[model samples]
Target: MDAPFSMYGPDFPFAYDHWLKHPEGLGRIPVNRHGAKVAIIGAGIAGLVCGYELMRMGLRPVFYESGQLGGRLRSASFEGAEHMIAELGGMRFPTSSRSFYHYLDLMNLKTAPFPNPLTPAAGSTVIELEGERFYAKTLSDLPPIFQEVAQAYDSALEEGAHFSSLQAAIQRRDPNAIKAIWNPLVKAWDERTFYDFITTSKAFRHLSFRHREIFGQVGFGTGGWDSDFSNTMLEILRVNVTACDTDQHLVIGGVEQLPKRLWSHEPEDLSYWPNGTSLQKLNQGAPRPGAAKLFRDPEGLYVTDRRGHTDRFDAIVCTCQSWLLTTAIDTQESLFSQPLWMALDRTRYMQSAKTFVMVDRPFWKDRHPETGEDLMSMTLTDRLTRGTYLFDHGPDQPGVMCLSYSWMSDALKVLPLDAEKRTELALSALSKIYPDVDIKSHIRSNPITVSWENDPNFLGAFKGALPGHYRYNHRMYGHFMQQTLSPDHKGVFLAGDDISWTPAWAEGAVQTALNAVWGVMNHFGGQSSLANPGPGDVYPVWGPIDLDELS
Candidate 1:
């Protein structure tokens, strides 16, 4: 499959590097603003990218982290394992996440195809439900009922949503064709839930309820999207149309390497900083203490660290999860208007949990005595274990297995359990699938587990938009372009996956970070070169059509 050029859709599909190539994004900063201070809150991909790009443009950006770096891009390793790691947060990168690949390519990270179910990389997949187990090497191998469910889904996407035509329009960069197809979809599906679309679409509604249940259990890309059924249909379309949930690659070693390397990397021909200067060298090898409070002072924006150290900056870009504005930090009442505050506070996040264990070797590779197949395949079950995945480092190296990867209701069940108990529960569930196999005997190290909902730093895994949430998203994404804000709100900008058209993807984080970077540049009197226009310079022409006007 060809890599997608856009993040949102046909209208806003320019690759981040391609957009930057437009003399507008070669990231030129005004000569006078070379040493201006800009405070970036959060060291996640969004914050780190914003700071890195700003530094390249010759501004001094100070970063603050309330927790560890890499935010949701975190990875966990076993005590003695050298190469094996369990991705605790964001793991897979789709070929269509063009903006994200700009950094991934620059870092030259090695990637392996993620083991999405039924895909070639997964090798084989097991779908078990209600005590009935079905094994398939490919979609063709699945039972007729299962194949019908898959076909119905494709038909619905094509008929109800114009999936293929929109994809072609995006490929061809035909603006009129894109607007004709995608704008209608935005109007039709933006207000509906995934379930609504599933139950009402002509092709899907013709199928039996059993087909819908099976489709929910083993979704087209990744695993079950039943957790997302209650989310907005627009959210589902964004994932599918952009190919974010398919053709994914896992970062070798760890995904955190992208942000970590960005921290230490130096760019050539910097406008202001020395040629060898990097973000690490600028912060003296450690970030300033975590921000405990943010408020406006008479002269400029002020940030108070956890230790009570206060510093003033010309502008502040907040890339942390939006809920932190109300829960974690001491934010002043006047910082954001009530409407914007509502959008930030109302950003709904999904609960997620992952438990991983290191095994002596890739034990699953052992062939079953009767079937001549690997004892265990990447398994998806309606049982307590929603999804089980295996990660092989090498024949000689320790291998990692994500025992029980679940979301929403399933994630809540293991939220109170410790790492050992989580691992034990997962193993117990797997025992039902492989009743004859000794799964626990292969354990080599202490198991690692994480519940994103249980962590204070990140209240939940990632934002999953609910129905009627398009207005909220529009308000948040447009914060950078708001010109009528009061003095206190003028300099503080919002940028994160939640503040983008599509949340929960690294591409969303990268695109929004660039938006905030441009906002800061313009805030300080910087301009994109006439030959190359920035996102802000070109947004009105290529952005999403307002759904209200279309309706």
Candidate 2:
């Protein structure tokens, strides 16, 4: 499924390109809208995708970028070695993100299976905790205690949340069954946190504290759940039911390529601009400076850039991180209503950090002379360094290693250190796992590190909704259905992953951008045909459960 609780038939969930190609979707925009200008703030994927589709609908999109072109999908390369890149943001994407794959397929970007735990790509896994090391080539190779913990997790997913029933219902696209199973979940779990679900569930309650601690430190699919323990149960459920945590793949080179391609690619046939028109060309080969302030005028919405240059457009799509509206940009109070402003302001973002180093070779592949085990395939530990990943380019070519990947408290730990210091700290921690391997000797270049929480362009990595935040999420996610919104919110639309049902994923960003596109088209007197209605036309019937009534 594209999203856990989408209004669309579960089978048809997140078929974004299908909706765009449908006669009703394509025909919704009025011909008169041709040549009309729309301002898109932030050159991220959401903004770029929205602009790309809007241009196809015969509207001109002028863009504003405050920082680099590819917002959170950042990929940094070493000074001399450009081929070996370190992904600082959005490293892996699951297969369930079908809507996002549309762009990847369109771009013909290469991909390889990500080395998630127990996956084939992760040749082996080493779990280290409390001065003990356990190496496993597969899940079965682990000790019985670990196996029991994994089983308990699976059972909890089914018994506590009706995981199996819901999965079957979604597979069959049974709307009635979906509502029956999912609606109650929203009401019950919305007020609870992930930790609450784990501890309160009978399956986990029976286990010892050590078992629970191990489960928290080395989670099944990705790594750990401790970072997200305080987030709402609904958020974790969404990740599980939709399978966003498994069967993931990494974009070759970098995830940033998707948006960069959309920025320059010109669709076939004619719109108002011309056959060869693209967002890059429309903006005169570069985006206007970052939007510094926004205010409404008699003619339309006005945006003033950091350089004091101002531009006016009929409508504005604010795709920047929500926090920027309140902190970075000076937005007029009247632009959005108070409750909407509250929702935006309350959007909580999670902190994340990553440190990467290029090594002379894939020395990690060497078997430990004494243990007969591979030094480390993918390492997960409870040390200062949470997770470490190794990327083997080739046997001879230099390898890239993500020395340390952490979140929340762990992320904050290295915020004060520079790249060299961060590398030293990571190496010190990793030495405990592989004392025989001289990791420092294999290092070829200076390490690259990032603390997303400290980056000025993004206050934090992505939104992590807390318990009791459903009402706020409801307002933000449903803002595109114009009839339900106030007049003040009509001219300005929000489009970003943070506003979506599944935050921090590119699919959510794409889905919300499409919602904003439909809203903008409707604002200019567009309508979807009855037979092949756009997402907006069918959203009321198939959309998210109304938490307001439950409240």
Candidate 3:
């Protein structure tokens, strides 16, 4: 009935996928403006992508990085092992992320279904919460309460958000229909929390509090929703409508490869740059040192690196976490309006910690003699180690295990611990759930761990918007339409998953980067091809709704 699932926006309902797939190409700048330099801060997916697309348009994008090239798409390899890596961030990417997939396929990388809980790829899942454990091959295999929880969430979506109709409109790419249903929701739910939605809904209220608790531990498409309970209901609804939690997959080599390849890979088609030209060659093999200060002067916008080397550009794209503007960098207050600055300062990010280890082999697949159950399974629990995922490389080679993956308060518990200590704490918790299995006996390498909040470059893993913060998100997201802004705030742009409706998801990063590309092109006095309209072309008619004081 509906087309293949896509995140076409219940907010800004534009077809970015079609725009990317079109034959006419994104657009072209005036011949005189072809070599204009745009400074891109941070080398994350957003920064790298902004660089890549601008490179294709023949504009020079100078990158400034304070840390690793791949920001949140971090993958750490074992000491000696080449490909045995632990994904530190952005593991499960949903199929609905067509914009991201466009680049993924262009790079010619491979993907396999992610091992999400209760999915076929996982083979089996074990959910342990409140001291009770259950093994299930699918949702039906779980006890009645699990099924009740699942059904109740579906019913609540229909009751509170008109999810079916809204999703159908998105699937159809029907802007008018989507806006009709979604705009009202923004008004009604902008001030409500995700926990409030669950408690107030008849679907969830009909069941006991245990139903809500169990559902939080094992939510659809991913590990847990408990970490997101305090977030705004509008944020949660966007994830659901976009299918951000379903049909997910992972890059086999590692997600970091996405940025790595894009940096070095040269596109066959080019407007002004030569075919062999790449972002890497342009930057002379590495990015400039980390940025320490940014200010606007009479000449243009000036970006100062950590080494005090300063460079000026006509435009700039800031792809780092917004907080960096205040905490890490000496950004001039005049660079943005007070309202826009408020949105950036007010943006919230959630903490995340992951501890991973390389094992001898896929030993977890080994079955018990007493019963045919797996020795261990992809786990979801209420303990300190909230979610543990198993990765099987092959029967012959070694395997990878995410000993513990947690967020919010759970992440803070291990924020102060070292890698070894975190691993020990995780193994201790797993032993409680799988008492018979000596998980330590199978270990083959030292543990690798990350607490993003501990890293000054990245204050937190990603954003989690709270109630009444929708306006902040709106202000940051739509600021790219800088035509109406004063001269000072027009050139610098913000682009990241944090600025997107679906925070923490890679698609959000991809979509917003594309939006920044459009804004930059327009800033340079360029327009999209008439044959295939870009987001900017359709944005005026399909942009996100405006919620003002009068409303």
Q: Judged by lDDT, which candidate is best?
A: 3
Q: Please rank every candidate by TM-score, starting with the best.
A: 3, 1, 2
Instruction: Note the Cα lDDT for every prediction shown.
Output: 0.85, 0.84, 0.91
Tens digit of per-residue lDDT, candidate 1, span 3-99: 4455545436444657654544555777988889899999999999999989988999898988888888888777866567889999988977877
Candidate 3: list runs displaced more than 4 Å.
none
- How far out, in Å, is residue 418 in model 1? 0.5
Per-residue CA lDDT of candidate 3, range 444-496, in tens?
Answer: 99999999999999999999999999899999998778888899788999899
Please give the lDDT score at residue 220 for candidate 1: 74
- For residues 370-483, what per-residue lDDT tens digits would candidate 2 score against the true structure? 888887779999998899998888899899999999999999988999999999999999999888888999999999998988988888999999998888887888788877
> What range of 10 consecutive residues in model 1 has the weakest lDDT sum?
2-11
Off by over 4 Å in 2: 1-14, 21-27
Cα RMSD of all models vs. native, in order, equals 1.7, 2.3, 1.0
As a TM-score, model 1 comes out at: 0.97
